[model samples]
Target: MNEIIRLQVALETDAEQIRNMMVEIERDETDRWYDNDERPFIPGYDSINMQKYHMWDKKYYKIMYDDILAGVLLISYTGREHARVDRFYIEPTFQNKGIGSKVITLIEGMYPMVRLWTLDTIQKSIRNHKFYEKNGYEKIGEDEDERYYCKTISEPIKEINRFNSDEDFSNQNFIQCNMQNVDIYDVNMRDSGFTNMNLESGIYQNSNLSNTRFTNVNMSNAVLGDSNMNKIEICHVSLADAYIHDTNLGFEEQKAPLIMERCELRSSRIVDSNLQDLSICNCNIEGMKIDGILVSDLINIYKSSLKTEINKM
Candidate 1:
């Protein structure tokens, strides 16, 4: 799962690009960041007027998360000892993945000479206050509607891309990125870290796929050979259908879809799924529950009744 969060110099098309994406943001969240006068994120904001307003100079950037334009920032007076963050906003879909604080930290490295940084947010944004405070900014003053903040930097901070645990990761588009022969290992990237990742024609060996959602995707012509698919859900999609090979249905060319030997199947669940003509053999079935009844118990009761009938015969 590649999560590339980068800040690039604002381009000519960035304003319109970000505006085009604004329609995708949640309605309530859109209201939160765009309803007021000092909304901080102006859709019509452009680099030309940004430079004109910031004494004819500014450091503007567009926040890119993977292949999507997630947000933008405008820093005025970057050449001086003091700088101001004129505007900073992340799309609602891009927020809460922990991007804001990291953006603030990156700004520190962008301007090495700026000993002090300043910005203000709407007073209603308590999360913004806490976010700034968490990043070492202190509240200096506040008026009726705006809350001012400033942070001091003793030295230049180096920029690093961590995605801050809130990465716009998984199922992300990698446009024009050449990723050939990349080796990934020894990471805590489980569950949420790699959800909905595009593993098309990818190999996975000796991996534990816990809490993975394999629903509503096409996986036609996948050669499982009875690999015992557990917890995989597909909706209104029939297996082996030609249309199932597409994204909406999705798995094709099963290069060893699954092979299990001496495996543990304890506490595994299969629910609301088709198990027509399923078979099991040479496996442990102790305390195996089906519809809340133990398989062992059912077998024992059957055996007892059979013995009694044989004696009568």
Candidate 2:
């Protein structure tokens, strides 16, 4: 019988462990896919290449089962509109044990309206499609080769602005704080701990979130235009549907934490932040530090535009 396992998101500090897990999984899958009678033809090199890219771009979440690395799920974002599950694979030994389903459920519970892609040719893929369908995902489109398919998870809209005063809120604790639909215009939250707080659908225009902590905080559907987030320490913070424009995020002493996904910042100083799939547009970013980083299309366009302007001068 398969052992019951619990899942948790891996941290950036666990990079080496995650890499090793990826390697082992690749090797095992390669052996199975080639040796099995079905011969699915899944490329092991492709898995390795994708893992390397994810490590370089910092675009994956390590799925831990009972404190052990069981599998990996590659996450990608397209603008503020949606998040995509680019790749997901579990170990052969751990397959068909409801662990994958549990992980998907956890992700969907955390982030509603998430999207995922899968190939149609593989027989196992049909079961994958069924799994997603069982979990409230609906098919939206398919490609010609029957290889590419898209699905989305729809969820009910939750209330965004309901603060609870009964709960004790220490200066260093943001446990279960609801900042939804609340307008925090021009406030200073430096060095404060807002970890695990849900700030969905909130507006934080021209506010300072410098040196603040946001571990596992949910800021989905929030608008933070023209804000200051320099040196903020964030981790596992969901910034989906956030509108960030003209924000000042400069400084060396203050470094934002890792685990920032699906955030949109325009004309903002994003030095030394774990910026995977972050979309930026129409910004003056001369002398910016983006070395050895995988920037999104919007940021690339902004950089290209900046280069063009400089060349014209």
Candidate 3:
């Protein structure tokens, strides 16, 4: 399981390092952020820019991932109901690992009273445009060299289709959409398609999962309790350290590697699964059986030999 990402307030001691990172970001965009027509001269990228924006309403947060610094976020609350994301930059090495989206989601959850959230990005950066759009932001307009995007938080719920009726969904594409908080219990999803979709906190109990596929899907903090998983497949999915309690992994043949660590199995059989590199430590074993032989009987035989050795001594 991965640790949750967080943002801490940037301290005064972090000023110089933050400025250095900002400078690096500016240099990464050499031809961008230049002046076309100067209404008023502004230092677009400067070391003392934070000091200039040091106010009660403005905030700077240091992005922390797994207890390590990974990025920075600067925002301002201009009014009681409005907020703006002034700037955000993640380390280049940590760009596309879902940290940016998670950080933005956390920020939005932090400010539930905020109605209108706005931001401006360089128009030349096509990737930036796609990112904001994927996060449900609408492109309102553009000015000089900046593209303005806004997301109204209190907008009406748009109607969305949530159920499928015995339809084949295999080999289809569904990207950057919300399927969160939807009921999928006892649904026929065999050979279905789910890619890059937010199915967070969705239920999948008593469903047909044979030949069902999942890639890059967010199943964070989900429950897979008391479900039959006979011949089910999963690849590259985030399970959020799920608890698969009181179940048996019975497979006639192994296809992929299975890893079981820090778990408890009582009165269960591990058949035909890949146990290569399997480790069992710090476990209480009594009346155990392996390969149709009583393990406890074997240990007792070995202990009897120890007693014989003691009699010889």
> TM-scores across all candidates?
0.42, 0.40, 0.44
- Cα lDDT tens digits, model 3, 1-313, are 2866899888777767767766766665553444554322213445554433432233778888897777888776544455778778886667778898898899988876566788888777788899999998899999877899998786533453334546766556765656544433224566776666666665443346677667776778654532556666564444444544334465447444455444445566655444566666676667568787877788799999999999999
Kindly list the per-residue Cα lDDT of model 2 for residues 1-313, writing each as its tens digit. 3655554454556656656665666677545544554434433333333344454335477776766677887655432224566557787667887887787777655555333333233333466667767755556556632343455434445553333434533454433555444432213467676555765555554467777665665667655533576545554444443333323335556644334444444444544335565654555445444564435555788999999999999
lDDT of each: 0.58, 0.54, 0.66
Q: What's the lDDT for residue 181 in model 1?
A: 31
Clashing pairs in 3: none
Candidate 1 collision pairs: 97-166, 217-249, 217-250, 218-249, 218-250, 218-251, 219-250, 219-251
Q: Write the per-residue lDDT of candidate 1 for residues 69-139, one digit (tens) a residue.
A: 78778776522456678778788778887778778778777767677788888777788888989989999
Each prediction's total of clashing residue pairs, residues at least 3 apart in sequence or on different chains, is 8, 2, 0
TM-score of 2: 0.40
Model 3 stretches astray by more than 4 angstroms = 1-3, 31-44, 48-52, 55-58, 155-313
Q: Order the candidates by lDDT, highest first.
A: 3, 1, 2
